[model samples]
Target: MDSAAAVSFDANGTIGAYQIGVLISCVLLGVTTTQTYIYYSRFPEDPAILKALVAFVWVCEVAHAICVAHALYQFTILDYGHAERLFSRLPISLDTAVFFNALIEQSVLGFFSFRIYTLSMKLYVPILIVFLSSVRFLASMVTFIITLRLPSLQSYNAHWSWLSIAQWSTSVVNDVVTTAALVILLYNRRTGVRRKTIALVDKIIVWTIETGMLTSATAIFMIIFYLTMKERMIWLGAFTVSSRMYSNSLLASLNSREALRSMNATQVSLHSFVSRPGIEILQTTTTNTVVDITAKFPSQPQPFQANRQCEEC
Candidate 1:
């Protein structure tokens, strides 16, 4: 191999190492977050759905860890010729794992949005969002498989340009749609002059939207980095590792005890105020009673009469 090829190969190794570290971190964060959410949060009011989503994320993270580990092992433990043969034959493995990881992330986000929607009583929209997300996830997987199976796969320069464009375009479209839906939910909650239930739902929707936006932003950055720095191993590694870390960290924060406590406190307060009947009436009556009692004091005329009698005596 020439100097450029040697450099490219070395860069791929660095990217693989960086990916391993990122995957490990993601697994840890996912585990921690899942535990915290399950133990500290309100259990999603539908434990089964929550459990399923958490399980999905955990499984995906495990797959990602496995793939990364395999890549690392291949690069470190095997000779170049052997590693090349193995990867060339099983290139789909790592790619498929990553596609699944992305699917898991998207599924978790969709479920979270659904949870917010359910709580707010906006039931119909979540179905559409989930469907759209699922379609996008499937598209990503298909593209990944196609890329893996393409002939001349060993030529890094084989210009899988169409696949790359499709992957990014689909991803961007998905994010835009998801983000827009979240924004609409938030706006409806804020502007709908209906009962306080809408307001409560709004708060939940806002939280859900913020979390989604964070994840989406990280994904966008990762896609951009991957496209622009495909040939630069250091840049690719840095972007991939940092983006993965941000995503995992955000997930961890969402499932943290602090997040649960805050959410619980807000829910409790809202429920208490909404469930209590005659509270406003009672407060009004108490104020009125105090005023009436104060106003019932004897007039100064009695005091004047008593003083006049004392002076005469």
Candidate 2:
């Protein structure tokens, strides 16, 4: 085969991977919208700043989706039957989408970093997270600029590959560090708390780990693919999905607050019921008179006579 035919044959896998990535990112856009709606409906009383942040993130996600879709359409439809074009031409939409992804990721990271500061009542960890996130975003911006200037897809690996690697590396590091800080802060809060409260904290910690693992793992895979298959576009495909993970994780965390609050309230109610002052019991099932009276007159507003007043009456 001639050189042009060889390039075209190799480009097939890259295009296929890119197509799959675009589809997944689009699906995640739907999830982002749902989570945004849930947050607005459930947490109307949340601070204006928080509401604004959600709106901003949603808008960025929408923009990113548009760019990704446009890029795919340009390649598969606008330039159909011309695999040589894929090698010779670069899609502006693809590069622009990278910027939007960087923006979304940076914004989410900032929010989480602030949360870390609030929870830990400390500065160092949040600052570190912020720094790493900023570095990653800057690296992404630089990569986008450099890619746009490159002559062809083949040239990407030859020049400014380090920026691509740096961008993904910092993303992984930021996610892991932020997740560890939140988990540690939450675990510490579990101390000196009731069992139910501890359970609630554990749930939050688990979520933190899961989200952290997802984003970090995605970035790690992107790096691995980029390094191992430097000529292929598999890593770019992973990049598309990794961006969506940030917004989804943030929205998921926000929407869960109400459920966590309900769990806490339920636990408190159960604890109160089980520990009512005048409901003492013995081993033989010989119920106290106060318990009998309260059971009989459950609607009574006044406390019944007992060694201690019937707090439940």
Q: TM-score of the candidate numbered 2?
A: 0.82
Model 2 pairs whose backbones collide: none
The per-model lDDT (C-alpha) reads 0.44, 0.72
RMSD of candidates 1 onward, in order: 15.6, 11.0
Model 1, stretches more than 4 Å misplaced? 1-17, 20-46, 79-92, 116-128, 151-159, 190-210, 233-313
Reference-based TM-score of each model: 0.59, 0.82
Clashes of 1: 0
Candidate 1 per-residue lDDT, tens place, 114-152, comes to: 533532445566666666566656666775676577653
Q: Against the true structure, whose TM-score is highest? A: 2
Error of 1 at 21 (Å): 5.9
